[model samples]
Target: MAKTKKLAFICYPGQETFIEPIVREYEKRPQYQVHRYYTDQQADVIAAVKWADILWLEWANQLTAVATQVYEIKSKSVIVRLHSYEALSSLPTRVNWKVVDYLVFVAPHIRDIVKMQIHDIEKQVCTKIIPNGLDIDNIPKNKVFNMYDIAYVCNLSLKKEPAMMLQIMAELVKFNPAFHLHSAGGWQDKGCEIYMKHMAKEMGIEENITYYGFVENMETFWPGKGILLSTSFHEGHPCNIMEGMARGLRPVIHNFIGAKGLYQEKYLFNTVVDAINMITEWSATTPDEKDYRKYVIDRGWTKKSMMASISKLIRLCGKKA
Candidate 1:
């Protein structure tokens, strides 16, 4: 057996959700011992880094350590995964990428943005596109496709454009009055959720849009929804899209920053009208569940598939799995 190495995973605020599934899978790996450093306990972060053969800074943001502790990680192999928001924040500019053995990206769009925005990034900075992993096997296979019910999952935020989405939904009602939209997820403090609701009210489609704030079990939202809508101005490969697919909701995703590179053209759309047309087309001729299900499996979103990516990541750091 390979020597058991201690692995440190540090999670920042919003990151806990995306990091949990990966931590669960890594804990199951026999070759490595996993230590999860939830957030800012400076001493814990330092100790975890010291004890770890490889330190994985879950978010490129905080928990990767402030600049002072950043130097401590220079002696050890470090892996940092950067999501979309961090690229725009001060986080990327703060990191010393030279010490990082591997930089992980949830999607290519964010990767391109980071590369362009960050200053003095190491020429040899090794990067990998590891989409967020989910335990699909645990998500029960049940869906109630109410053709009129459309679902949007993700916290209401400027980037998510809840108001714009409501505007589109309002327009969608014109084509099909029975077309109801359900959005599950809380409002980010800066999201202007009230403004979005105001827009819904102004558009006179407030009743057509049902807001179920902060849903714990998202699978329940997918059933009875004919189309899953993703209108985020940007994203880090959201779980909702794949989870919606798991429940067999035909996905209608907007052209997010770099979504085209990651997803098929058939699913990506340029405008609300385009997405509406696509959903209409899907309704006219439904897709084979088996084919879409297979598509999700092949993309390597499952816990089993993610393990393979982790194994490769271990190898990249010159460790045995």
Candidate 2:
């Protein structure tokens, strides 16, 4: 019988959305003993690090920075996955890169940003780009396509650009008052929330927008929506865009950094006018729903593809340990 290796996934609480799926996959395999340590306690962090033969740190945040400084990790292989915020923040500067065997990046632009910020990152660790993936096979494709109905799913924050979203909605309502926006996700910034409410009423487009707060089950919520709109300043392989696309919803994403590399030109928009034109133009032609879903499949952005690559990397790291 093969020896069972200890694997620990460490991350801060409430940030385990991406790591949870990977942990479920490893639990089913016999050769791995999986443990998820979601805490910031110094003693607990050290215990988890010492117990595992391999560590998968979800974010290159404070938890990871502290974990890398542990003495026991010298004998254990480590993989740190940096999403987006860490690259822009000072957290990456504090992380000890020499101890990390594999540095996984969700997008190429994020990797490039981190390299520029942290000197000799490429030479210190083996960097890999693995875009965020969705479990496409299980996501039921019950799309209710309507050109007038737009869907927006994301936590409202300054970076999400809720103000820009309002501008788009205001323009859309002018084109046709029937144009409505259905928004999900909670507010992370109180100021943004206050501003969004005030601006929506001031702009006279409040009647055209409906807020559903934070939706727990998107499968049921997505059926009535037609178009998925993303107006973020930046993103690291946004799962919301992929989730909506998997459900056959046409996406109108902002031209954020690295937007063109991940999505087709037709799906991207730079300004409110550009977004208005894309929707108005698409409504005229009316492409098939299958095309949206096909884009995700062709790019190999399914959960199966993502897990396969991660699993191979895990095995390679384990062999080295």
- Highest lDDT model number: 2
Deviation in angstroms for 180 in model 1? 0.8
**Clash count, predicted structure 2:** 0
- Which pairs of residues clash in candidate 2, taking residues 3 or more apart in a chain or in different chains? none
RMSD in order of candidates: 2.5, 1.1
Candidate 1: stretches off by over 4 Å: 1-3, 65-70, 119-124, 284-287, 315-321
The CA lDDT of each predicted structure is 0.75, 0.89
What TM-score, over all chains together, does every model reach?
Answer: 0.90, 0.98
Q: Which ranges of candidate 2 are over 4 A from the true structure?
A: none
